[model samples]
Target: MSENPHDQPETLEHPEEALHRRAIRSFVMRAGRMTDAQKRGIDHGWPRFGLSLEQGLLDLDQVFGRQAPRTLEIGFGMGHSLLEMAQVAPDQDFIGVEVHRPGVGSLLNGVLNAGIDNLRVFDCDAIEVLNRCIPDGSLDRVLLFFPDPWHKKKHNKRRIVQLGFAEALRQKLKVGGVFHMATDWQPYAEHMLEVMSAAPGYRNLAEGGGFVPRPEERPVTKFERRGERLGHGVWDLKFARSE
Candidate 1:
C-alpha cells in the first residue's frame, strides 16, 4: 500500500529558520488612523530618518554617522518612548522597528523635530528585520516594552517571548548586552521568565530570582501611566548575554 501524502516524513527546518517562524503573532496589524502629521512624517521625514524593510544588513556606523552603543526597540507604539530614549541618550544609536505605519510616522516625525542624529526607524516586522538587517553580536541592548499580553489562555502561545525568541535575540546582542522587557500582565511575566531562564547564553539581571524593579532607563510612557491609574501591576525583566 502506498503511504498517504500527509504521511511522508516532513523536512525539518534549520534551528535558525525555525526561530523566526511565527504561526501566531502577539499583535494584530493596526495601522489605525493616520493623521495628516503622521502622513507628512512618512512623506517628508522618511527620506531622512526612515529605513526600508527591503534594505539588508545596515552599516551601523554610517547610518548613525558614528560608532556608538546601538539599541534596537521592537513595536514602539506611537514612538514617544523611543524618541524619549534616543533624546536622553545622545551618545547611543537607536533603531526602532514598528509595523504600524502611524506609529512609524510618529517616530520619524519626532526624530526630525527633535533634531536627533542618533536615531533610525524601520517600518517593518521585527523578526524579519532582525534576521535580515541586524548583524550578530552588534547590538548593545534590545528593548521590548508593553508588548501585547494576548491574555486568553489559548492565545498565550502567540506571545513573542518564546525560548526560540530569546535565542534569536541573544545572537543579536554583544557579550554582556542586555534585553529588557516590561509588561503589565502578571501571567505573561511568568511566561517570559520561564522562557528566558531556559534559553542559554543569558543571565537574569534580577538579583537571585523572580522579577526586578523597573529600570530607570525605561522612562514611563502615557500608556503605562494610564494602566497604573487603572491598578494594573507591571513586571520588568532584564537579562544580559553571557561573556
Candidate 2:
C-alpha cells in the first residue's frame, strides 16, 4: 500500500527545531496510559538468549520433554489466537513475543487457566528476539497476524515487512518452513506482498491470494473481530522457505 503522505514525520530545518521535534515525538509516543514502571518491568522481565534479544535459546528439549517443531507468533495481542493454536497443535511448540504488559499478563493467565504446556512467552521486540536469539533454520513456522499497519505515511518505515527483516526470517526458517501473515488493512497487505515477493529464498505458498484457511487451527482474534465489525478487509499471506 502506498504510504500516507501526511503521516510523515516533520523534517526540522534548524537544530533547535529538530531537538524539539524529538522531544515531542518521544513524549507523544509514551503518552499512553501504561505507566513507566509497568513498561520497564515488562521490558526487563524476559530473559534474552544469544540469538534473539527477546528470547533465549535454552534447551527446548527440557521445556517440552522432547524437541518438537517450533512455531513463532509475533505480537500476540491478547493470546486468544495463540492459545487456540496451541490447543489445536499440541505436538508443536509455540513461542509468542509481545511487548504489551496487559497483553502479556492476560496471555500468562490464559495459559495457566487453560493448562497449556506447549507455549513460551517473551515480552519484548520480536526483531531482537528473532535476530539475536533464535538459531538459524531452527523454526518450523512463523505467524504474524494483524500487526500494526502504521497507516500514516511518515510511520510506514516502522512497518515490519522490510527486505532485511524478511531476509532474517528467511534465515531462521527451516527449508520448507512456513511463514503466515494476516492483515486487516488492505494497503498494508499489498505492501507485505510486495516486500515478501522481492525477498529471495522464499516462495509464496498460495498462487492467487495465499494459503487456504486453516480455520480449525487459527481462530480469529479479538482484534480481527473488531476489524470485521468495522467492515475492514482481511488478507492472509503464507510463504515457504525455498531451497
Candidate 3:
C-alpha cells in the first residue's frame, strides 16, 4: 500500500547524491511485467480516457462535458478505489494520476469494462500534472491514499506530505475544497498531520485537529483489508483549503 507514482526524478542520479542535492523524489519506478489484458486495456482505453501533459492547462468543464464536483486522486495504485468512487458518485468527475504502467493499464481496462464516462487518467508524475495541466482553484477534492512512506530515518525527507507539497496542492483546490489523505503507516500519518497543521491556507476537518475516521466515500480496498487483518491501523486526514 506504500507505492506512489509522484515526485519522480528527472534523471538517473545516485540516491545519496540526489539527497544531498535536495532533489528528493517520493517514488522509484520499479519494473513490473504487465498482463496481456492490461496491455490490451491500455491500447483500447487510453485513446478515449487519457489526459496528457502536452495538453497544457486543462479546461475540466470541457473534459467531462459538465461543470461538476471534481476529485483528483494522486498515486492511485491499480485504480480499484478510484473506479469505485467514480461509479458510486456518478455526478462527480474523477481524475487519477499514476506513473506505473501496469496500474494505469489495469485502471484503463477496468474503466473500459465499467463503461464509466466520469473518470480520466494521467500516466505521469503527479506534481508535473498539477503544475502544467490542472488549473488553480479548479478541483473540489484531492485525495492521496496510501502513498509511499519512505520509512527509513534518513529517507524521511522523501515523504510527500511536506510543507511545500501541501502548499502546492492547496493552490489546486477551491476554497473549502478538501485534501484527504489516508495511510497505514502511523508515523507517516503523524508526519502528515504535523506538516499539514503547520501549512498555511488550510484548516483540518478532524474534530480534535488530528486524524479522522475513514469516510464512506473512500472504499476499503483489498490492500486495506489485508493490512487490517495484520493489525495495522489506518489513519485518515481531511484538511480544507480555507484561504
Candidate 4:
C-alpha cells in the first residue's frame, strides 16, 4: 500500500508526532481558499514536482537526476521568488519546504506554468523536513526569506530563529555553506542577529558583524515592495557554517 500523499507528518516514521508539532509551529496554517487554477496545478503538477514528508531522506543527486549544488528554501510562501531563483540558477537544484496547502497548490501551479524541472517541494513543517529528510552537511545553501515574525510579545517564542533552530541549521549546512535569511520586520531581524551571533559553528558574512544589504539574487517580494514604499526596512543576514 502507498502512503497518503496528503498527510504532512512531522516524522515519517511516527505520524503521531504531528499532533505535538502543531502546538509549537512557527506558522499557523492559514485557512486560505485555493483557486481553481491552483487546485488544477496540484492535480497536474504534483506527480512530477511535489515531494512528500513520507518519502523520508532523499538522495539529492538521484532526486535531481544529476550532481549539482543543492539549495533548500524553508517556507517559500507562494513560491514566486523561489521559482525565480530556480529559473535563474539552472545549475542548482532547489527543494522548497512549505506547509500551507494553498501555497503548495499555488506554487505547483507556477511550476506547471513555467515548465520548470529543477525544483521539488515538501508540504510540511520546515523543522520536520530538516530533521527527517535533508541529509546533514549536504546542502550548499539554505534560503529562509520572510518567515513569520509572530509579532506579539507572547508569541516571540514561536519565531523560528531560536538558538536551537540556529544550531540545527548549522549542523545541516556543509562547511562554507551559506545560511541566508531576510525579514522586513526590524525587531525580528534583531532577534535573528542576536541568536545567530550566539550560535556556535557559524560566522556572520556581513561587514561590522551586522545586517547586510540585500544581495542581488534576492528579488524583492510584492509584500516587501509594499513595505519599502511604506518606509519599512528589510534586513538580510548571511552566515556560513564553520567546522
Off by over 4 Å in 4: 1-23
Question: Which run of 10 residues does model 4 get worst, by summed lDDT?
Answer: 1-10
Clash pairs for candidate 3: none
Q: Scored by CA lDDT, what does every candidate get?
A: 0.83, 0.68, 0.87, 0.83
Q: How close is every model to the real structure, measured as TM-score?
A: 0.92, 0.76, 0.91, 0.90
**Candidate 1 lDDT, tens digit per residue, 20-112?**
564545567763788988888899889988887577888888887888999999999999999999999998999999888899888888887
Among the numbered candidates, top TM-score falls to: 1
TM-score of candidate 4 to 2 decimals: 0.90
lDDT of 3 by residue, 128-205 (tens): 888789999999999999999989876787777777777778888999999999999999999999988988899999
Best by lDDT: 3
For model 1, give the RMSD to the true fold: 5.5
lDDT of 2 by residue, 61-121 (tens): 6755778999989888777888788878888898898766566655666666667678888
Error of 2 at 168 (Å): 0.3
TM-score of 1: 0.92
Estimate the overall C-alpha local distance difference test score of candidate 3. Answer: 0.87
Q: What tens digits encode model 4's per-residue C-alpha lDDT throughout 82-170?
A: 98999899988999988888888988898888887999999988888887788888999999999999798766777777766777777
Clashing pairs in 2: 7-154, 8-154, 49-56, 51-132, 51-133, 52-129, 52-132, 52-133, 53-128, 54-129
CA shift of 168, model 3, Å: 0.7
